[model samples]
Target: MDEIYECPQCNQKITVPSEIDRAAQLELAELVHMGRRIDAIAVIIAKYKLGLLDSKIMMAHITAQKDTCVRCGNKLLEDGVTNCASCSALNLNWQ
Candidate 1:
């Protein structure tokens, strides 16, 4: 069953799939931050046993909201390397 959550700030309803738990989200974010896109995709393929195209789509969906602080989800500076304003976490745009 899908989990429904209410956004505390916006009071909007959000539906989340059970497969993509918080820990998996964090792990994918970490892999993206390290510029290991292939590894990230491989993880999805192995976990879901999906083919290449499907796995790529899953990876894209997982990381569509990139360029944010992996630790705090703060918008990152565009300089390619900067510290997150909210949590002092390092943000690097390796692409």
Candidate 2:
């Protein structure tokens, strides 16, 4: 069997390479280097709750770089975006 790494906090397999997941640590290397502190921490908490290695990866899978729609959970828009394609309708749910 492959050697596996499990998180002590939640007892889940650490699938994603720890190196790729800067969001989990929310690196405090510098003030400017900090990765979404709140969101990263949320990702840490949400990881166990959601059964994943990292919340950022989870969000990326679900929301794609956290680009989902605030109203309908859509992720078709460009980066640093807030609204989805159908912001007004807000009827079609993505989840």
Candidate with the greatest lDDT versus the true structure: 1
How many pairs in model 2 have backbone atoms within 3 A of each other, for residues 3 or more apart or on separate chains, i.e. clashes? 0
lDDT of 1 by residue, 22-58 (tens): 6766776678767788998888677645577655543
Clashing pairs in 1: none
Instruction: Tell me the alpha-carbon RMSD of every candidate.
Output: 9.7, 13.8
Give the clashing residue pairs of candidate 2, or none: none
* Top TM-score prediction, candidate number: 1
Q: 44-74, model 2: which lDDT tens digit per residue?
A: 4545353434543333322322444433565
Q: In candidate 2, residue 42 scores what lDDT?
A: 61
Off by over 4 Å in 1: 1-17, 64-95
Cα lDDT for residue 59, candidate 2: 35
lDDT of each: 0.55, 0.35
Q: All candidates' TM-scores?
A: 0.46, 0.22
